[model samples]
Target: MSDVNVIPDMIADPSAFEDDAAFRLKAAQAAIRRECGWHVMPNTALSGVINTRGGSVIRLPARHVTSIESLTDRDGNKLAYAYDPETGLVESLSGGFPAGIAAIRYEIHAGYDDAPDVQSVLISAAKRAGMSPVGLVTSQSTNGSSASFDVVSLMQAEKDKLKPYRLGGLP
Candidate 1:
């Protein structure tokens, strides 16, 4: 996935970000991607490999796939397939994928062109990381005040918003 610096512009004051803000933002992006099981922003072509256990239907390791640039087997043989752009499901038209490690290689365009909810979640996470004192403060209390930070992970609300874009089954 490409490095997208959207958090800086999303913030009301870019200066509010600390010196480690870039790192924090990157970490936030990575965390979201990890949760989603794919790069969920900036639609682009990505090359990847998937192992299959002899199945006609193979789900790509991505979401919102716009197109498949190429799909080949281990022997570099192009395979005929049909795919759903929304769910990343590919149906083999010729035959089921052979069972093996790294049996399929593909280049595909996937992810969202404009996902405001995803961007919002990323910004929220980045801001939370920036405000943390030790970068690991899950919960803290001072005098009569108490606060908890999700830190590198998403809160339940954020996860709910991103559920549709998530890969595999359930978060």
Candidate 2:
């Protein structure tokens, strides 16, 4: 993932801002993931643990789950489960999972293989960051030229595009 460039070629000239672009892209990706509450890009064989709510159905802390490599109880006993790959909803076939903190362990592949909407958000953020002058100047003027930097943030429309990927019922 580190070697992959999420920023599109049409967004900026890679040759001129190679290092800066990489840095900004990374920052933007992190911000997006933080906002969305999960990794929006594909991650294979990722291990995760979640507490059970004492039900047959449990929601994994992810979206677009592709596969489940393993599912186990707190005692390391293998558990049978059925899951919806798109919703991350897992149902235990071996009765309900016990209620406890981090009682379920799972290894799964989840998220989009390629999310263009997410990429667009990243590009927008990176571009905003790249254009702003360093430090905290909201507005600057020199030699009859002036510039104003709007704080870099996801627009409402961008946030709307990410809604489906967000966790914890946040809008």
Candidate 3:
């Protein structure tokens, strides 16, 4: 993890009035607005993680997203989400998002807990579903573990492609 600066949420010193709560709040709001504005637009490309219920969007570098898939209960069974290298962001969603996504893992997850190992599961699932996993890379995250690809792109891509979906449940 990168060093997280823990600045006091609010400065109390009156001498710091020029740098006081109101100014800081405005600055913070402006910064958030800028990022939120970016989220409202799509970039050339993007990548992120979606949870088991098909919710939870985690934005990371595009290169970090390792897989994607369209899920199905074809066998009259609920399938577990898996990672697919070929079904990576640029290739898979470039045409359009898969009908059902089991899960999307970022390069950062490699070697962490259930992550890196899930890469193989993703590949198998994609094959079973008749999709291909490509552009897969063994890399590290900003934290420097055996990470996978998160999403990568200009601000616009995520805004357009990923933002509208609700988190924590099916669409």
Best by lDDT: 1
The residue-by-residue lDDT of candidate 1 on 48-126, one tens digit each, is 7888997899998888888889999988999999986655678999868777899999999888899999999999988
What TM-score goes with each of the models?
0.76, 0.73, 0.20
Candidate with more favorable, higher lDDT: 1 or 3: 1
lDDT digits (tens) for residues 1-171 of candidate 2: 343433333323323534367777777787788889888896556797888777899888887778788889888889888887655678889878878998988888877888888889989987887776762234444432444434356768878888877975532
- Which residue pairs overlap in candidate 1's backbone? none
Select the stronger candidate by lDDT from 2 and 3. 2
Q: Which residue segments of model 2 deviate by more than 4 Å? A: 1-19, 135-152, 168-171
* Lowest-sum lDDT 10-residue window in model 1: 5-14
* Per-model root-mean-square deviation over C-alphas: 10.2, 10.4, 20.6
The lDDT-based order of candidates, best leading, equals 1, 2, 3
Number of the top TM-score candidate: 1
Tell me the whole-model lDDT of each prediction, alpha carbons only: 0.79, 0.73, 0.31
Candidate 3, residue 129: CA error in Å?
A: 54
Relative to the true structure, candidate 1 reaches a TM of 0.76
Model 3 backbone overlap count: 28
Error of 1 at 163 (Å): 0.4
